[model samples]
Target: MKQTWFERAIFFSWYCGIRDCAYCFMSTQPDSKKAVRSKESLLAELLLCKKLGWKIGFISGGIGAFSQTKFKDLLKDMYKVSGEKFWLNIGALTADELKEYLPYTKGVVGSIETVNERIHDKICPSKPMEPYFEMFEDVSKLGLKNAMTIILGLGETIKDFAELKNIVEKYNITKVHFYGLNPQKGTVFEKSDPPSAEYQAEWIKKTREEFPKIDIQCGIWVDRVDRVAKLLKAGANSISKFPILKKFGSKEAKEIERQAKLAGREFRGTLTKLPEIDWDGEISKLDLAEELKEKIKNKLRLYLKKMQKNYF
Candidate 1:
C-alpha cells in the first residue's frame, strides 16, 4: 500500500504565530525575543512546503490583534504565494477593527489564554480581554466561524474555565481547544509547572461534560491520547499537537514523532495549519449572528451614515 500525502484538505495545516499571549515557544529561543518570523524566511519556508508536497505550517512568538503587522509590505508577496489556506492567532481587538479586516481572513483564533481579568493580566501584562468583545461582536454580524482557546495552569480557577465555556457557548465558537501553559525559560512564569497529564486528562473529561455542544481539544504534546482520550470517549472530535516546526523529514523531527508513538500519539510528517484569531468576528457580523450582528451593524451602519452626512 502507498503512504498518504498530507496534500489532502484536512491534513494540510499550518500555525501562523500572531499573538500577544504570554506563552510562545519561539520566544524561548536563544535570541530575538518578541520576534516575528520574517516574510522572507516564511516565503522560503513556503517554497520548501510547496516542494515537499506536504501541507504548510507557520508559528510565531506574537502576532494578530495584539500586535500590528511586522511587515505590511510583505502582505501582497505572501498572498501571491501562500494564497487562502493560512491560520492566524488573534490576541485582542475591538468590534470596529474586526469589520475592517473581515474580507481578507480565512479564519481566526482568539487566544483568550484565560477568561479571568486578573489572571489574564498577570499571565500577559499590559494586555486585557477587551478584544473578545470585538471578536464576539463581529463574528455575529459577518457570519464567521472561529476557534477559541483557554490556556490552563496560569492560575485560573474552575470558574474561569466555566466562564470560557459560557463565552464559547454564547458566541457559537465552532472549534474549542484547551492548552497547557508551557513556560518559556525567560518569561516571568518560567518556573511554573505545566498542568500534569493526569490533571489535564481529568479536565478534558470535565470540560467535555460541561460544554457538550462543542468540540474540545488539549495540547497535542501533553498526552495526545490520554489528556483527551476521555474527552473523545465523552464525544469530543477534534485533537491537536503544540505545532513545533521540525524540518520536513529531519531526524530530530522524526525522533519526536517516535516519542509521540510512545505516548500513543502519532504524526505522519504531515503539515498542520493554525489560523489567525477571527478578526472579522472581532470586527463585524456580515454573517448574521442575530443579536451581536445587529449591535455591530448598527454601529457600522451608523458610521457609514455619518460619513455620508459628513458628521465628522
Candidate 2:
C-alpha cells in the first residue's frame, strides 16, 4: 500500500539494561544492564531506516538515560547514521544527563511513567526510577522541547493520574502519551489485564480537563480517544498509536491516518486535525528489514535458551 505523508515519523528501536522491562513484552526473565547494541545489529537497523526515508532515532532502551556506556554507543550510532538530525525518546533519564544530551536531541522524552514513588518502585522493582524525575525539571527548566509517556493500568489508581498531571504541569513537555499497560503472553505481570478502554480514556480525559495545557495523546486504543475526544477536546493536541514498539508492522499503525482523520471529525472544531500517520505502511514496505529483525530475535532467543539449558 502506498503511504500518506506525515509531518514526520518516529522510527523506534529498544533495548533493556534490566533485560526484561518492569512490564515487558518478552517472555524471558529480565536481562542485566551491561548489554549494549552490537555495531553490526545497530547498523542494520539504521540501514533499514535509511532505506525507508525515515529520520531514525531510539527509545525506551534501558538505563541509557543516565548517559551510560550502552546509551553512549546508541547515541553515537544514531548520530552516525542520521547525521545532524534525529529524535530520541529514551526512557528514564536524569536531569544531569539531559544537560549533556539536550543539544544532541531534536527532542528527548524520559517517560516518567508514574510519579508516585512507592508505586513506581513497586512496579519497577529492578531499578529505582524515582531519581529520573529530575529530568522533567531539567527539561522544563532548560526550556527543552520534549515528550512524556505515562503508563496506565500497570496497577494504578485515579489518584495516580492526578499526581501525574501535577508533575507534568511543571515541565515544558511538548506531548503527553497515555500508554495502556500491554500485558502480553509473558512477563511478571502477564496475568494482569489492562484497564477497560472506557475507564482508561475517562481517566486520561479527566486529567486533561483538570490540567488543560499540553497536548494530551493516547496510545493503543484510537477508538477510545475518539470517545473521550470531548473532555479532551480543549487539551488534546494529537492522537498517536504505538502500532510498533520494539517490533514493527502492526495493524494499528496503518489505521492512524484514517483514525486521526475520523477522530478529528468526531470532535470537529474541538480538536486540530493533524496529518495522517503512515506507520504501518512504512513497516510493510520495509518487509525485508522487519523479517531480518524477527530472524535476529529468534536467533537470540534460541541462543539464550541454549545458554539457560546449559547452565541449569
What are the TM-scores, per candidate, against the unseen true structure? 0.59, 0.61
For candidate 1, give the lDDT. 0.49
Q: Which ten residues in a row have the lowest lDDT in candidate 2?
A: 266-275
On residues 182-299, what C-alpha lDDT tens digit does candidate 2 reach at each position? 7767676778877676766677677667766655665555334333334233344444443222212333333443454544533121112212434334334433456654554444
Instruction: Supply candidate 2's per-residue lDDT for 225.
Output: 34
In terms of TM-score, the best-performing candidate is: 2
Query: For every candidate structure, what is the RMSD over all alpha carbons to the true structure, in angstroms?
Result: 15.4, 9.9
Candidate 2 TM-score versus the reference: 0.61
Off by over 4 Å in 1: 1-35, 47-76, 157-159, 210-217, 220-244, 247-312
Which candidate tops lDDT? Answer: 2
Alpha-carbon deviation at 214 in model 1, angstroms: 3.8
lDDT of 1 at 124: 63
